[model samples]
Target: MADSTPLLSDSESDKPPEPKRPPRSLDETIERCIGGFGWLQIFQAILVSLAWVFDAQQTFISVFTDAEPSWHCADESVCSSFSNICQLPKGSWSWDWPAHTSIISEWGHQCSTSFITGLPASSFFMGCLVGGLVLATLADSTLGRKNMLLFSCLTMSLSSIFTVFSPNIWIYSALRFMNGFGRATVGTCALVLSTELVGKRWRGQVGVIGFFCFTLGFLSLPVMAYVNRSSSWRTLYLWISVPTILYCILVHFLIPESPRWLFVKGRKEEAVTTLKGLAQTASALTMSFSNVLIEQESLDDNVDIYSSIRILLNKRWAAHRLTAVMVTGFGIGMVYYGMPLGLGNLSVNLYLGVTLNALSELPASLITFFLIGKINRKDSILGFTILSGVCSVLCVVMGRVWPSLQIAMELISFFSACTAFNMTLIYTLELFPTCVRNSALSMVRQALVFGGVFSPLLVAAGRKNNLISFGVFGMAIGICGLPLIGLPETKGGVICDTMDEEEHRQTEKGSAAIPTLA
Candidate 1:
């Protein structure tokens, strides 16, 4: 240390200090480019979120289309209001409406076994399950979010239009399968794409926009079904499909691909241009993307279709998180999907009941949007599930003594389930890094549809007994939310863009926990 202060010359010391470099991580770069949650980001999120509207339309459309219309006594002496139409003489009892109004009446499935009546709904969910498994990784790999969203939406819309021409139950069921297969990725892609378009500060809020759009779609169904109460069920398909096709056209023309996806796919230049276009300020536009230093593993130039899924499976922590979320989603999905479909069994007016159930989702979406930052994802989900379960079981218990109290309890139960459903998706989104985010989300949705597969059968059997549908729904959601205890909380945390980055973070945190032996 003899000459420590005399090393530099006077001329060298006179030069200005070098500027410090900005963070090169993709997350930071994205935040810099986005600048703030501006109108551009809001518009982009709305355009992408509109997909969930059509998705919701397709998901609950069957509730009205497949419903069995009211029946009446053709011969007063032979049949009464309480008589079983299946056992009553065919001529003595006739449907209150024309046969063409519902699939159950049109296809002569009213008196058929429950298995036959539940087939179309079950098949649709099964298609979702299979399609999710087959198409899940494509978004994370070659197709990317925008293309996958476009393809899946277009396919779903076209199939829905074709469903209008079905001649029999077999053909209708087959077409429903195709529709479900196509619609499998709609919500997943839309949620992921919309959130990815925004900065971390707005991701959760942006994601909730999709749920609101979905609610609008759900709300629209009851109105449309009421308007077409006496019209053919096929008309509903056309009404939803034509508008969806137009939406697909708009998406194709207006939406930009996700910048994060482009960068990870080794298309850096496109990512930079996309980021620049999203930037509102002149300074952000001028900021160079040249020195951004993402991990090499994130740049997969030729990522295989199954590569993202394989990556998720290979990681121990990722697998555990995936399993936990999926189990929780299954519970939420059963009640979320089943409750509306089973509305016919309730004593209230079908359309009014459906409207009430649809309206219950409004506060859920608003609550999620307004309090997204304050809510703890894991704890909220657990609490909602327990509340939903309690309300659901009470619906059954209270229905015996106070019949009017049943719908109110059911509404609360469904509302709780809806809140839990929204949080589950957003929570799953944050649980994984960007590289395998879509694949993980798709798997969770498949678990959701897997639970829905049994919904129709349960709803059908529950016609005679409420215990089968509502009772099981209560238990499933209550138990499924328990696994969240073992998972880590992600509230107020920065999301990672790469597997290597996330791994390094976890490793460092683990290392920090070890105390010195001194």
Candidate 2:
């Protein structure tokens, strides 16, 4: 009516675009960051979080079982009491006997069950080791995140059920291993799913929030252990299993397939429909509806399976890879496995100590979230690594000087290690392009497993010379931090979608007159 085309052109040319502002309301910010997931997704995230709690509960029930009372008959009672009470010559023991002797002694004799319980725990991690590399890669290819998550949950639930019915330690361990295989799929897929849903501005926050859920799982373990302490280990296993099975069913129905993965696989209509549904759910107002067209670009369908491997071997990536592996491997290996074992040695309240250790993760997550946006990635990583290393050294020195301080030292060490571990995960995710993100993450996961394997040996060796193991662990953390000087800072940078973009950024940085490591 009023020269609309000319007015629009003139207005567009004259007005400058508004600068992106930080969100004022936390809820609005989170919604903006998470995009389109809505209340159902939050509920799903909670369910997934609880599933992880059960996962840890299943593994940690052993510690409570190990410390439970057992029944044992005295030699005199064995000779006198025969039949149901006690069998003298046959060496058979029953539940009934003298109050103190039967409950405490006989129960103590069955303490080997606790050790046997640990076999499944180890097997679960081993399963994670295998599944992370094998099943996680499928997140990008054949299986989308939703399907993979459902499969993992289903298998893990089945394994948990089987574990509850396990006739012996071997069956329990095998089922736990199977469960671990499924558990391995959860973290990676959850990560990919969260990242795909969000825009670039909020990827880090979403990643950290996902890890926060994991930390919640860790924190909840001690509560479960404390509640189930008086119950039979089998009962404890059953308690943990039921919730996970229910969660699996919920996930199967409620969670949708990742639209990005659908797009990648050339399921354009499905992806478009899914996006539309998400928009409807979020009540998102500013979506570019006209731009909803599915544009297919030429993708490298023939990409080498070993492509990530080659990149990791390259000079630029190799250094970061080695640093990430060594630091993360050591940090997670110590923080997760070492804390419980160390607490067991100190005769401290294992559940309390573990809970405290897990609770420390909240602050760590907060620290990373605050600092990741402001500071350089390399500095944040290096700073945390040094902090952990210093704590490790303190653990050694303090453990020798005052045995009472061992508990305190363990707490400090756990906090430091967890902070470093969280940083390493974020840094590793930041280092790679989207095309090979899963593969690169898998490589780092492999390093974590490798570290896990060595952790037991280190703990065993520490039994002989406690100071030595702590010292070695501390030194490793400090040394690993040093190489970070060479690593590039990725804070505030657009996440690279391809290797070419990454290489171009590197070239541009290299050509700049000013040195840019900071």
Candidate 3:
């Protein structure tokens, strides 16, 4: 036994030293050094969230800008200010709005030109599709989150600026498409960057701020539209664009590259500098934070930016999860984007309708911010989707029998849909690791845009048929949720850094497990 013990000691001496783990995770280190929910973190998140505001405004601006104007019969010049122009014969009516106010009004779009009016909205969504396919990878790779966000914001703002000068609807539609292309990465990049900047304990709180900003932007639209009701729509574009252009400059100066992403790319020195800045901001007494550089959490992030999606899709479970989330997101996207465009069928005040619809986002944001921390993400997504779907179906059934009741129900559905959208985004953030998080989200959001591409066409073609507008949205969201049954609950699990780790994680959680944020 003594001889054997010496042999064991010799063998042990020859073994390599076990690699040391990081003293604490980046999230933990940030919290301990900078204080949990620190002002520095909050300020960074708020700055990043400004992008959401501009994104939301530009996304829904078309509802006001492209809307068909009120009109009266040209022959019936005797018609006073008191009558409904829609009641008169369609062919005799000319637009009440000036050519510069709305493209539909400027181009003399009656029945003959009605189809072209939907083109701009569709074109914008199509641009989103193309951009997501193209630009999503840059954030995960060389450009990083801050750079991609700044670029997207700059491009989107510049596109909006140029849109104000378009000579015709065709040029205007083309510019809007370019704007969509530029804006495609803004929400994804902003959300990922801002959330990663904070500790896990504060991630939910910080994430909700983006949604709140989006809701604020939505609310602002009605007020802006009302204030500019008599002015050219071009003026609205110009007003919104200038601030965003300035925001791009602020982001460049203020927002740092995501430290998490820097570590993923093996840029440890930069990560050290970023953390040092955070410590300095919090007035940390000790800046000897060499532990931040000692051990990076994982090296599984995509070094090959071009094949990030391939890395994601090549994994079986990942492919399945992505497929399901994207399909469901498409359904949600259709409803979220469709409601504003379809509101005119309710025969309510356009301004009031927009205000009410926009107002719904407030409660949606509050409810989402409140419950997401408590409930399971799957339960929240599945339950809210069902509720929103029911409300939409009711809108169609009760639209004629009780018009006022129908509007109320539609608003409820819109609010519910917004809540579902918020939950889905939060849930999506947990589904992938830091390596592919931005890319996955970018692609999923593009699925929403793909669904949105069809919404404007449907709203225009099915103006009289409430079922085509509301019913399709309801059915798609309600039924598409079936696939979610196969997806696991991802409420309290660690995010997997590699496909193998994630697959094993799914097994340990009993096969129905979904990815989760830690």
| After superposition, candidate 1 runs with Cα above 4 Å error | 1-23, 293-298, 511-518
Question: Could you give the C-alpha RMSD of every candidate to the true structure, in order shown?
Answer: 4.6, 8.4, 3.8
Report lDDT per candidate: 0.87, 0.59, 0.80
How big is the RMSD of model 3?
Answer: 3.8
Ranking by lDDT: 1, 3, 2
- Cα lDDT tens digits, model 1, 310-378, are 787777777778999999999999999989988888898989998999999999999999989998998
Question: Tens-digit lDDT track for model 2 on 334-441?
Answer: 545555655554545666777777788788878776766777766776777677777777877777788777667667666766667667766767676655666666
**Per-residue error at 66 for model 2, in Å?**
5.2
lDDT of 3: 0.80
Task: Tell me which residue pairs clash in candidate 3.
Answer: 488-512
Best by TM-score: 1
When summed lDDT is taken over every stretch of 10 residues in candidate 3, the lowest stretch is: 509-518
Better of 1 and 3 by lDDT: 1
For candidate 2, the 10 contiguous residues with the lowest summed lDDT are 22-31
The model with the greatest lDDT is 1
